[model samples]
Target: MTPESAALPGAMHPTDQSTQGCTANGEMILVVEDDVELLELLGTLLKSAGYQVAMAKDGMTALESVTRGGVQPDLILADFNLPGAINGLQMITQLRMALHRSMPAIILTGDISRLTSRDVAFEHCVQLNKPAKLKEVTFVIASLLAQQRNAKNDSERPGQFAPGIARSSIIFVVDRDDLFRHTIRGVLESHGYAVHDYATSEAFLADYAPGPPACLLIDAHLPGMEGVELLHQLRKNGDDLPAVVISGSNEVSIAVDAMKAGASDFIEKPFGRSEMLQSIARALEHSQDANKKLAWMQEATHCIDSLTLRQRQVMDMVLAGFASKHIAAQLGISQRTVENHRAAVMTRTHSKSIPALARVALAADLRV
Candidate 1:
């Protein structure tokens, strides 16, 4: 479908148009598209639907807008085949790194077949085909925004259980082959894991939620979206469920692509049970370690934000490798006072040594 088709009558539902002229409730959206007319149309559409819209013509410009950081978007809509070296996924990845959080996003693509799984493995993201119906676009945006709101509310709720603690032990299997799915399910169930099998990736995605500590075993040659693409979708949805990709071919490139798409491991067909179990164990461990590190970094950032002006100064000097006497001289303070401030910094930040303190500082984005 062409861009002109998108603007035809009956393209947008009556309910969607009813939102026009309403206040946006402070939600902001970033739209990145290279086509000038399409970009304007999207921006106008979003604005009419009660959203504050920001527009960028390419991936580079979108990235620059994010880095400059005045208006942080509540959601992002980016074209997949953006001009320049950085595509939409890369731009979203860069923004996520800078913000240290997963931001919701949607990718619009003209030729969905041209994209590989590696192009979609971004946290809190989904893809939509180009010339997308206005109703479909509005529905996706509303769903993502609603999910974000629910997540925030849950986090802020008092006395909530920590993430992954109450998760079900159900393993998900996605494969086109009936025998393969049956075999895997039987094996996993024998090992004390409840198993759910699906013949298509779309079926699995439709039923997926982020509430389970389960692992995914997916076949590389599914009928619709490939295994790698399924893994990418899982990651983009902010579901950190560990995944293992099973492929009949022993091609190194296929394995590489699977791993690049964020699969925990790639296993060739005819694998032993022991090998599969070990891979699953390792993926779970990796997920645990990643969660721990993210928690520590968030705590450290909070600690850094609580520092006094003098304490922060002392920390900067300490990170710069300055001795106590030198720091005292530089700050026009006594050596004993400098030592006291340093001790307080370490105590408040829970740093055992200078190197540990430096790690906390770096995680908090402090520069010396």
Candidate 2:
């Protein structure tokens, strides 16, 4: 439908009042959903909120209604996994093609893991998880319409930010149990963090990207890839992001493995909010300090290329809790040679002491 033809009168026609109740002239919302109960609930909510409502049971009908019936829906709320051949993303794409422009849309889904192209690119398009409260739905819809109206009035105005805004950070939440995703998201959102919850290692890996949250909270026992493996993957990939492991396990071996794999800290699950927050804060603080130390180490390394490879090896072992005798045995060098290399390394790097050199090595990504 052309823009002019799809624009309906301000109010619902008198004949439509009995089913939807009286509605004021608000934005027109077209809800295309296959679930009957969900559709009716959403329709009633929108109608009560002063919107001129339209409905379609599937993508084909919705497309037909718009292209042939001359119904120009101002905004669309659709399901990601829809019945029949056309899905929500395809429908929106087709609509944009037919209308020669993009229309605002929301994808409602039970599977939050399914992210479409529209969700990633368009700031106007939102994803609302299934079983959304009526008030929550109303708030999101109103917010979008307000944004559109504001843009119309002054295109230069900035868009609305979600409440409790903060800079983006890496958020690693691992829970084999499905419900924790919602709980963790709520907790983080309440504290002004934009949260991304992962159900499994596979999900996290698939969705993984650079520049994630400032912190990670991972469950110790994730499906397929355990927390240790996940941490190893991140470390191997050169992502030194701060991470906290949440585990129900009490085995010291598990904790040791996690630490060896580069986990900043570990905490037992069913932990109180205070414990969780403290762990996260500590990890972030350590990561920040580690980054600074690493920068210094890199500068030092550039100036210390004169040291032999064996001297650097001895330097790493000494700082990693090895005495001269053990360092000699490990590197197959004599104790005297290990001592000489250790002194040469410290001198070359200008490290004041063995402890300082060890810190530098850690920052420099030493393997031992």
Candidate 3:
């Protein structure tokens, strides 16, 4: 149906209004969702809450409504999983670029986990999990629109800082169920992710590729190295690999154990497409963050490793909370020499203070 047909009479229609005017006010709301019933439901809900509401069935229609029809709303409440070339995320991104403004948005979806930090990083944007109550939805919409108005009033305030895009990573599937594992791999591959699978944790570890960013999706009841135990082992081995545990039962105790064992997320068996995708996406986002930290730590460690033996001794003593005079006495060196070595240690590590040096050492896992 066309945008006009989807709205209640005299409520929302194609606009002759400028994008600037629409963005400057909180008078209209654009709803983009594929579910017909939910679409009508939302239109009614928003109208009752005293707001003009426009509706679209998919992302392409939503994008065209704004770009071609000049029907940009002050706030967008869209579902992430839309049909056609653009999804909800793509449509919002395009709109932001086209309008040259960070429009307020509410990302309504079944899975918030699937979205990375960069995807919902815009100002006045909030994400709500699907099947939310109407009251809660309206509350978020009103809250964001209020913030938008406040920001517009400021006029000279700077926009929010947007982080760089997150890198997609490989997904490792460890499930003894051959059929289930195959199905999972097929789904993830179709979504454009690199995938690898193993029936046991031992096999996964033996052939693991440490150079690339990766996350694990393991069945809780494996033949050997039970899923939670595998997470425990990885954590014990100092591996911060993000993981999701799946089980046939939805036992609270099992989920608790998995979480305690360092699993990033947990899902019950026989999950649907959205469920699986959200879990994997959440896990991969964690993996991306872990990789970033790993990179920073490696660089810091390399810097620390370059210090001379005497400088290193001085650094260690400072880290141990030794006074400068005591450190000099122990090293059988003059206080002036000790001070010089300490200064060299600071310069080499790029640290301004003892605590700063300590953080670098701990983060890089160097000997303190």
Candidate 4:
């Protein structure tokens, strides 16, 4: 069909509601999704929030709708995995070129790696890793559109969305046993924790979402990629998402292996609900403590990285208990100059004393 003559499949002409007292300014939003249920849900959500909504099943149709004048979308929310060969990122790029300008977009994907700057750099594009809550989705949409058009700052009208589910923590349960997984999920849900369970490690990995306070429960004897192996792999990939290995066997050796693989805790099967809950609480605490330590180390590393080569040299010598005169003689510079460099290092690192500077180096894992 020709661009102008072709009709969009699921286009809705929502009344252009006033921008006053509302986040939506009656802008058109194109939603490209293959999941029929999700498409309808999003359509309803947007329409209620006072937006002109259009729906396309795939990237090709979405591009056609915009390029053909059937729908002039002000914003686009597309699923990363679509039916055709064209992915969400590629579709966003082509859509921009067709429109003759860049526009704000949100690309929802299960792949965390797609959140890299390179993929989201063309314009005011944002990558929201999947398995995200509906409120998160709406929040991003509202914020991006507001920035794009300088719309009203009113929060999403309170009654426009599903009643907010107050969740304490998110939990992932990976086990080969469907019955057991469901049981655990039910328990977590009853406790007001958002829980998702998978029958395999691969499935869990496929839907892994980063940047959330979450933990994992993995069965030690999983059919493929056993729990300890999964923990090892996650640690190797530098993912510190705390995990607890659940095993049917109670061998000390298995627990030892799990600990070595970076598991925060190990639990034997036939465990009580209280035991499981306690382990999860402890694991979460461990995760929070680790996060604090990591934040401190990141700040330390940033300070150390800001130093010049001379400042770093002086810092190293000073940290190693070398006097200013000794550092000058070794580097063939004046003692006064060495002292000046040391002062700069201390100031740059925000260290008031030599011992404080040494602590920063230790946090950064820098060698003396």
Best by TM-score: 1
lDDT of 3 by residue, 44-145 (tens): 767766688889999888888888999868888888888999878668766765665556787776664532322453222477665555556666677777
- TM-score of decoy 3: 0.38
Candidate 3 C-alpha RMSD relative to the actual structure: 14.7
Prediction 3 global C-alpha lDDT? 0.69
- The lDDT of each candidate is 0.70, 0.64, 0.69, 0.72
lDDT of 2 by residue, 202-321 (tens): 888898786744677788787798888988999999988777776766554565556667766666544544345545655665565667545665875563556687876776566556
At residue 63, give the lDDT of candidate 2: 92
Candidate 1 RMSD to the correct structure: 22.0
Q: After aligning candidate 1 to the native by TM-score, how far in Å is the CA of 15 from where it should be?
A: 11
Q: For candidate 4, lDDT tens digit of each residue in 1-368? A: 32212222333222333334338889999999998877877787778777899999999999888878668888899887889988886787678657644567888777666224334532336777666556566667777787767744322222111112215568899999786786677556645568989998989889996766788989999877788888887888889888878876746457556665767667765654545665676567657777866877799899999999989998887766678899999999999999899888989899764534655676676875
- Candidate 3 residue spans exceeding 4 A from truth: 1-26, 114-118, 122-124, 152-368
Residue 173's lDDT in candidate 1: 88
lDDT of 4 at 128: 70
Q: Is candidate 3 or candidate 4 better by lDDT?
A: 4
Clashes of 1: 1
**Residue pairs of candidate 2 with colliding backbone atoms:** 6-72, 169-212, 169-213, 169-214, 170-212, 170-213, 170-214
Off by over 4 Å in 4: 1-22, 114-117, 121-124, 151-368
